[model samples]
Target: MCGAVKFEVHGDFDSFYLCHCRYCQKDTGSAHAANLFSQSARLVWLAGEEAVASFTLPGTRHQKCFCRTCGSAVPNTHIPGLLVVPAGCLDSELSRVPTAHLFTSSRAAWDHALGDVPEFSGLPKAT
Candidate 1:
């Protein structure tokens, strides 16, 4: 994880997901991205908020923000206390968290499916 920004989780995660959505792929410049969804209070930006840059894709709520200095994606608040943070940015151990894969149908053919995790064609109805 990049050290440009520090973060802490203030509450339990609602869910963690590996997204294969086209928007995520483009934003991450990767085959897929893992995201942790929780209340915005769960995210504590210890540094670098001033260096954050954001872009919103046309026709969708797929907004993304990143640190300009290190080019690491940062959490974007969705509501007063809700946030979606990229798992790749965590400094603590992440192995205990389980992530379900979403938007599997949009995943690149070259990317293999993750073992055993539940996969969804789209966001889960409950989410």
Candidate 2:
């Protein structure tokens, strides 16, 4: 990701969720969305506030904020006092883990039994 946008979260997150809803999958183009929710935390944008853009799905509360330069997910406060921060956007390490996987019934079919898959430190060597 281009480092066009930078921010700091000043308070602890209330919860972290791996959301597996259909909208979330469309948002990330992946299995789920890794989001940290906070009711009291403050997001201090250090730079590129003008480059940050947001989109809210029509007729739904679901919203996404991201850096326009690199398409990397960023924090959003569209829901009034609640701040929804994409977990992957943080430069610092998190002490808290995901609280739960939401909407499991909508989970991707290929998302099952992922622990059995092979692991690699990086991209695997060519066959």
Candidate 3:
């Protein structure tokens, strides 16, 4: 992101989820975090490795890495056998849609019934 960090995923993802845990919402600055999990995917940093920074929550398994230039989330190793890819960081197409929403109890109060919201093809014109 920010034209500095780029990467490639070398294997297929096995699962995808939308996480609504507090940490995820805070990390993503949104209602939830979309993540692709893979047991065999290899993350190959194509550029700006030096700009990659990571943080793990204290006393927790939640960890994240991001691009220093734009604070864009990037892939990071997960649980020794898996790779966590932020769906937004992927430049290519995904094989499948998110299978579930995790930690729904912690979803934002304003995030309910989103399917009813108006859809826009692009930026809505200013009223």
In terms of TM-score, which candidate is strongest? 2
- The RMSD of every model to the true structure, in order and in angstroms, is 9.6, 0.7, 1.2
Ranking by lDDT: 2, 3, 1
| TM-score for each candidate, following the candidate numbering | 0.77, 0.97, 0.93
Task: List, residue by residue over 22-115, the lDDT tens digit for candidate 3.
Answer: 9999999999999999998888988898998899999988899998989999888646988988998888877688989999999999999889
Candidate 2 error regions (>4 Å) = none
Clashing pairs in 2: none
lDDT of 2 by residue, 1-127 (tens): 6999888889889999999999999999999999999999998989899999999899998889989999999999778889999998888888898999999999999999999999999999999
Clashes, model 1: 3
Who is ahead in TM-score, 2 or 3?
2
Estimate the lDDT of model 2: 0.93
* CA deviation > 4 Å runs, candidate 3: none
Per-residue CA lDDT of model 1 for 27-107, tens digit only, reads 888888888887634666677767888888889878887888878888877445668878877767776464688898999
Cα error of candidate 2 at position 121, Å: 0.6
How many clashes show up per model?
3, 0, 0
Estimate candidate 3's alpha-carbon lDDT, on a 0 to 1 scale. Answer: 0.90
